[model samples]
Each structure stands twice: as C-alpha cells, then as structure tokens.
Target: MSALDHIRKLHLPDGARILDVGGGSSVLVDALLRENTSWSITVLDISQSALDHAQTRLGSLAKRVTWVAADITQWIANDPVDLWHDRALLHFLADASDRATYANTLRTALKPGGIALIASFSLNGPEKCSNLPVHRYDAQGMLATLGSGIILKDHWLMHHHTPSDKVQEFQFCLFQRV
Candidate 1:
C-alpha cells in the first residue's frame, strides 16, 4: 500500500476528534471521513483562501468537518484531539522557535495516547516547495524535534505523486503522546 494509504490505516478510533494541521488543500481528511462516518475532522490552515477552496471542494462533506483559519504556531484548542495529522506543514517551520511553538500547541491539545502522523520532506525531496524553503528530515531528526515522552509507533519513507506526476520524497513519522 502507499504511504498515505498506510497512514489511513493507522488505528484511529471511531468517533475520534482529528486535527488536520496545515490541511488546506489536502484531501486526506475527506478520504478519512468517507472511510469512517463517526470520525470528526477539523482542518486548520493559515490561509483563508485555501480553506474556502477546501470547503467548496468538499461540498456537503464540508458541513461535517470544522474549518479553522490560524497559524499552527498560535493554534490552541479548548478540547483535546485524538489524532494530530500534519503533512507538509512542520517542514516549513525552519526557525527553532517556530517549530517549538508548533510542537507545544500539539502537545497541549492532544490527549494522552493521542496519535500524531507527521510527514516531512525527506533528504532527497525538492529543496523548495511552493516557492518556500523547507527543512528535510530523516526519521530520527523528525522524532528528536518533537522531543521525548512521545513513543514512536512507526515510520516510512515514501514518495508523493504530484498532479504533474512529479514525485516528492517524504518521511512519515507516527507517534503516540505519552
């Protein structure tokens, strides 16, 4: 199975609250919702235009998913989340402080044993995406940044097939908050 397909199989519970960080145009949440009617999806992004586009694309499914427009660095949730889904977001946080803040937000919002599925540009991936610099990660580097206490459940190196059929290498790290 594909890396993304494997991520979908991560053993998230039914009726779980999932936070999709930087899930602007990502169809991952849509696919997850389709697979499990009981799951609640919340898509968070810094761009309103992107969120609007996602809503339009989701159509009726949009109502079932919550949309939040905010930078991940300043994100905080009143309720804890069961899963934190972050793909192609953490890599953009090249600054040490920004990455720390992003990590803290996730730590604060996630319940104990909550899962985090994060994907970052791999060492072989493009140097830039969307005209922005990105930080590449090997498995250990990504885990170390998130710190200890979180148990690493699994990891995989895979390539994403873009619209133009270009392939982008990435590392997916799964963790359970302890």
Candidate 2:
C-alpha cells in the first residue's frame, strides 16, 4: 500500500474532518471514501479539471466531499480540520517562501491534536515530475520547515514501482499538532 493508504489504516477518530491538501485527481480521496463512510473529506486543489475528474469518479460519494479550487499557498481555510493529508504536493513548492506559506496554512488550519500526514519526494527519488523540479525532503528537513507547533510522530520510506517497473522513493512524515 502507498503511504497515504498506510496512514489511513492508522486508526483515526470517528467523524473526523479531513483536508486533502492539493488532492486533485489522486486516488486517495476515493480510497478514503471506500474505506470509511463516516469521515468527511475536503479536497482542495488548484486544478478545476482535476477536481471534476475526481468528482465524476466518486459518483454518489462525491457529495460527501467538499471541493475547493484554489492555490493552497495563497488560500486561507475558513475552518480547522481534524486531519491534514498531502502527497506529492509540498515538493512542488520549490521555493522556501512558497513552502513556508504552505506550512503556515497547515498550522493555522489544523486543530490541537490534529494529525498531519505529508509525503514528499525523497533524496533518492526523481528530481522532477511532469517536467517540474521538486524539492526532496527527509523527515528532519520537513520538521524543520514545518516548525515546532506540530510534533513529529513517525517517518517512513516508501518505494513505489511504476507501471514500467521503475522505482520511485518517497518519504512520509507523520505529525500531530500540539
């Protein structure tokens, strides 16, 4: 299973409000729906088409998810969330300032004791995706960038084999807002 799938397996509180940051067309949203029916998810992404695709794929379950189309770096959330989950999103913000803004947004949106699961390209992974350069991060590096309000829980390395059998390395960091 992927890092996001593994994180979902870790027992979460019932009726938790989850924010899938930069979720787009990722399968995580659909997986979450099939795995748990009570949890409410908010899928936030900059791409309207991506959200549309996800919504179409979800069918009836799509109604349970709130779709927000906005650049996370500049967008401010109106309410706090019980969980913040992002995969392959933070690395897209190659600039320090951009990363800082994303981190700040997470800090502001996560409630006390809320959980955060972030996955980024590892140092060993490909440097770019879709021809765009990505910022690789280790657990300590992610913690340093995200700051002290969120406590690091665990760090896991994920090796994903592409359809062509090429392996991509990813690092997942779990945190809890204090």
Candidate 3:
C-alpha cells in the first residue's frame, strides 16, 4: 500500500496532531486536509520555496497548517505530536551522526505510543539520488538505526515510479514510540 493509504488505515483520533517531516511541496498535506479538518497538521521542510509553493496551492487551507522551514537534524519540536510521517527523507542521512540525530529528533517529536510512518530507499534501490549518495535500508536496518523505545508494527516494500520514468524501490515501516 502507499504511504497515504497506510496513514488512512490508521484512523487516528479526531484533533490528533500530525507532523509531516520533509513534506515540502508534497500533495500529502492537501490530501490530509480533505481527510480531516479537525486534525492539527504541520509540514516541516528545509526548503522555504517548496513550502511557499504548497501554501499557494493550498490557498486559504494553508492557514490551517503549521509550516516549519528547518533541518530535521537541528529542528526542535516545541510539542510532541501524535503521528510523524516521513517520505524519502531518512535515506538521505548518509552520516552516522546525522542518522543518530534523526533518531533523537523522532523520539523528541513523537509522544509516547505515537505512530511514525517512515519511507526510505530500500537496500536494492538506487545508490544515489539527485547526485547525492543515500544510505539505504530494509525494515531491520531501519529499526536498528532508530534504536530503542520504538517497536515495529508493520512493513512493506514498494516501487516508486519517478517523474523521469525511473523505478525506485522503497521500504515503508510503521512503528510506535514506547
């Protein structure tokens, strides 16, 4: 299933806080807005231009979302969220220290028992993207990198068809903070 499909299956409670890490200009926010008006959603990305594009596309609905332009490794969560969704972001952290920081950030951003839906390049996927090398992972590798207090709920493999007509393998994992 697609990441959005998995999120929809979650059936999160009304008014739940959601953090879309590196969501940027993704249409996920648009879909989420249509799904539930009561949800408090935040889209965090390092690109201000991308966020602006999303805001323009969203128009009035943009006001409903909190847009944060900061690197996940350095960004601090003022409040914990019920759900954390990341797509094609984790694999970009090639440095071990960066990966550790990402894990810590995830822990700090998610409330106890909250859900995290992380999608990344699979072991068999491209070695690099956008001319930058990526750290690929399978479900087990992801779990190991995330460290303790997070338990895996489910995982699956998917093939993403890029705009350039290239197929990229990805692994999607669902976990719960303890």
Candidate 4:
C-alpha cells in the first residue's frame, strides 16, 4: 500500500490531533477530510502560496484546518500532537545541523506514544530533486537520523510515478514515540 493509504488505515480516534509537516498543496488533507473520522488537522509548510492554493482548492473545508507558514526546523509547536506525518520532506535536509533541528522539533511536537509516519527518498532514488541535492536513506538510516526517542514499527519501499512518468523510490517508515 502507498504511504498515504497506510496512514488512512491507522484509524486514529476521533478528534485526534495531527500535524502534517511540509504538507504544502498535497491532497492528503482532502482525502482525510473525506473520511468519517474527525481529526483536528494542522498543515505546516514553508510556503504560504502553496498553503493558499490548498485553501482555495478546499474552499469551505479549509476552515477546518490550521495552516502554519514556517520552516519546520525553526518552528516550535505550541502543543504536542497525536500523529506527525511527513512525506518527502526529510530528504531535503542534507545538512547535519538542519536534520538535528528537525529531529528536535519532531520530538517536541509529538506526544508520548504518538505515531510518526515519515517518507523519504530511498537509497536507490535520485540524488537530486528539483535541482536540489537530497540525502537518501534506508529505514535503518532514517531511524538513526531521527534519533532515540522513537522506535521503528514498520517500513516499506514504494515506487512513485511522477507526472512526467519518472519513477522515484521512496522509503516509508512508521514510528512510535517512546
């Protein structure tokens, strides 16, 4: 199953707080809103324009979401969330310090026993995306980079076909905060 499908199957409780890191204009929000389960969703992205596009697409449903325009490495979550989701964001953190800051932010934002679903470029994936270099990882490497507070529960590789029909390998890891 795709990472998004796996997250959908999680069946988190109603009113569960969720943070979607770097979830710019992704349709994941739309899909979740269509589900019967009620979630307090927050979409955090560095680009306001992307968030605005999503808002325009969602129309009235956008009102249900909390949108934050800030860098994940710099932004501190005011409260912990039950679920933290990141898709294709971590790989962009090629710098060690930035990745460390990301890990710290993640630790601070996720509550104990919370679930974190992170997807990144796999080992065999492209070295660069959008002309920017990326740090590819397998499941183990991802866990190490994310640090000690979380334990890997499951991981799998998926092939994503871009609009241009280019296939990109991605590793999706599911973790639980200790």
Ten-residue stretch with the least lDDT total in model 2: 1-10
- Give the runs in model 4 whose Cα sits over 4 Å from its true position: none
Kindly give the stretch of ten consecutive residues in candidate 4 with the minimal lDDT sum: 1-10
The TM-score values for the models, in the order shown, are 0.92, 0.94, 0.97, 0.96
- Residue 3 lDDT, candidate 3, scale 0-100: 59
Of 1 and 4, which scores higher on lDDT? 4
- lDDT (Cα, tens digit) per residue for candidate 1, span 1-178: 5434765687777888998899988888778778788988899999999999999998988999999999988877878999898889999998989987877888887899999988999989988889899988888888788886677898888888999999999988888899
Clashing pairs in 4: none
lDDT of 2 at 4: 52
> For every model in order, what is the number of clashing pairs?
0, 0, 0, 0
lDDT (CA) for every model shown? 0.86, 0.88, 0.93, 0.90
**Candidate 1: regions farther than 4 A off:** 2-4
lDDT of 3 by residue, 1-178 (tens): 5556788899999999999998996999998998899999999998999999999999999999999999999998888999999998899999999999999999988999999999999999999977899999999999999999999999999999999899999999999999
Candidates 1 and 3, the one with greater lDDT: 3
Q: C-alpha displacement of 60 in model 2, angstroms?
A: 2.4
What is model 4's C-alpha RMSD?
Answer: 1.1
Residue 142 lDDT (model 4): 91
What is the per-residue lDDT of model 2 for residues 2-65, given as tens digits with 9 covering 90 to 100? 7456656768777888999889879888878877788888999999999999999889888989
